[model samples]
Target chain A: MTALLSLAIDITLLSVILAMLLCMIRLLLGPTAQDRVLALDTLWMCAMLLALALGLRFASIIYFEAAMLIALTGFVSTVALTKFLMRGEVIE
Target chain B: MTPELDTLPVWVSLPVTLLLLLGSAIVLIGALGLVKLPHFFQRIHGPAITITLGTGAILVASMIYFSALQSRLVIHEVLITAFIMLTAPVVAMLIMRTAVYRDLRARERGKTPPAVKDGEASEVYPFSTKKSLSAKK
Candidate 1:
């Protein structure tokens, strides 16, 4: 049972890492600022999920806290980036 | 490195494993779509898949795994799930609106022709007809 659980977590971790790599490619090659921002947002989300998978693997609460922090930061950064893209500045 | 998994029955472990795999696979597919799609608006649809169903699956897996392992309620994952659900669409909307705004401005300056065809323009942009006709004049 433990082996199965470990296998599942490992697979999830690997898949998310691959997803992040794909997002990175888009981030670098994206032709427009909006595409780049979209890639960044996806990258952060992958990071958050990666943190959660690690938490599951290690069976630790600390990773959960880290995941929450990532989520919060990801939202804020996405909002700020989009705002900048929209108005050419973040704040009025 | 072993933890409480040894004690879990097949019923519990099986579902958790399936959920994790399914969720990650969806996320990967979404990311792939984002990279492979031809346009920004089409690409926007990609991550929506991940944020809604992918995140939900993973969070539910985490919640079930922790709750089962600790023999107690572990619902904190819900917080992150809720936050993501509420915020992702807003971010997507902001980015999309910004893209449309930029494209429209470019059209007004005669930098590029209207992106959408006449038949599709009305559905996508209500003012597209007026803008395109005015720009042509």
Candidate 2:
């Protein structure tokens, strides 16, 4: 059972990492500012998932805290970035 | 590393494993769509899969694994899941609106239409013809 669980966790970790890499490629290769912003948003989500998977693997609450933090920060950043893209300034 | 799983029986472990795999696969498919889809609007749909179903699956799996292992409720994962669910669509909407705003501005400036398909072009920019006609004057 431990072996099976470990295998599942490892596969999830690998797949999420691959997804992050793909998001990075889109971020780099995106033709428009909106595309780049979308890629960044997806990138942050991938990071959150990666942190969650790590938390599961280690069976630690610290990783959960980190995942929560990532989620909070990622949402704020994406919102700010999208606002900037929309109005050319974030505060307005 | 293995201590957590040692407590879980095959029944519990099997579902957790399947959930994890299914969630990751959905996330990967979403990311793949983001990369392969041509238009920015089309690409926007990709990550919806991750935000809704993928994140839900993984969070549920985590909740189940920890709750089963510790022999108690471990519902904190719900916070992350709820936060994600609340925020993802907002972000997608904001980014999409920004894209539309930019595209309209570009069209107003008489820039050539992007390589969007004909059917989608009309739907995506309803006033495109009128704008182009006005710009020509």
Candidate 3:
């Protein structure tokens, strides 16, 4: 049973990697900067997902902690960039 | 039902396996939407699909599988799911607002409307100032 579950995890991880690749294409070829930002946001989410999936596959808490940190940083950076674009200044 | 059921634990594993497959497929579809959507505001909705359903399903599967394997609550997957749900939409909203602002500024400067915002419903760019954009007499 454990082996089967590991197999399932492997398959899902592969799919997640494929999804991230698709997001990368959008980041590369998006027609507008806004579209690119959208892609980058999605890319970060995918990376977080990938990390969580890794944690499950390996049964490792460390990967989950790393995923949390990545999610936190990604959220802050994306928000800052958007706010900067809105006001023409990142800092008041 | 005794020997097979005891050996396989089919009841528990069945739903977990299906959920894992389904969640991965949904995430892939969301990524497709992100790639294929025509514009920024439209694409902003794509990852939300992953956050709401995709991440939720996978986390649930993780909870079930990990608890079965480890013989404990194994609820840590909830944290990642919650984080994704809380963050994805906020980022999407901000990106949409920024796109709208950029489009308005470009138009005010006499540039052609950026392709993404051309036919979309417009939002007033709140950053506009009367004197800042006007020429001195």
- Using Cα atoms, each model's DockQ against the true complex is 0.67, 0.77, 0.44
Q: Model 3: share of native contacts present?
A: 0.61
Q: Interface root-mean-square deviation for each candidate?
A: 1.9, 1.2, 4.7
The superposed Cα distance between candidate 2 and the true structure at residue B89, in angstroms, equals 1.7
Taking all chains together, the TM-score of candidate 3 against the true structure is 0.82
After TM-score superposition, what is the CA distance of residue B106 in candidate 1 from its true location, in Å? 2.1
**lDDT of every model, 2 decimals:** 0.85, 0.87, 0.75
- Superposition TM-score, candidate 2 onto the true structure: 0.92
Question: Can you write out model 3's per-residue Cα lDDT over B1-137, one digit (the tens) per residue?
Answer: 11222233666677777888888888899999888866566676788887688878887887776676666788887777777778877887788778766776776777645553455434432344334446422
- For candidate 1, lDDT tens digit of each residue in B1-137? 55567887777788899999899999999999999977677788888988888888889999988888888899999899889988987888888987787777666676553334335444555566456657757
lDDT of 2: 0.87
TM-score of each: 0.89, 0.92, 0.82
Model 3 spans > 4 angstroms off: A1-4, B1-8, B117-137
Q: Which residue pairs in model 3 clash with each other? A: none
**Model 2 chain A poorest ten-residue lDDT run:** A55-64
For residue B28, model 1's alpha carbon misses the true position, in angstroms, by 0.8
- Local lDDT at B99 for model 3: 77
Candidate 2 lDDT, B1-137, residue by residue in tens:
66556878988899999999999999999999999987787789999998889989999999998888888999999999889888877888899888877777776677744635445656655665566557757
Between prediction 2 and prediction 3, the one with superior lDDT is: 2
Q: How large is the interface RMSD of candidate 2? A: 1.2
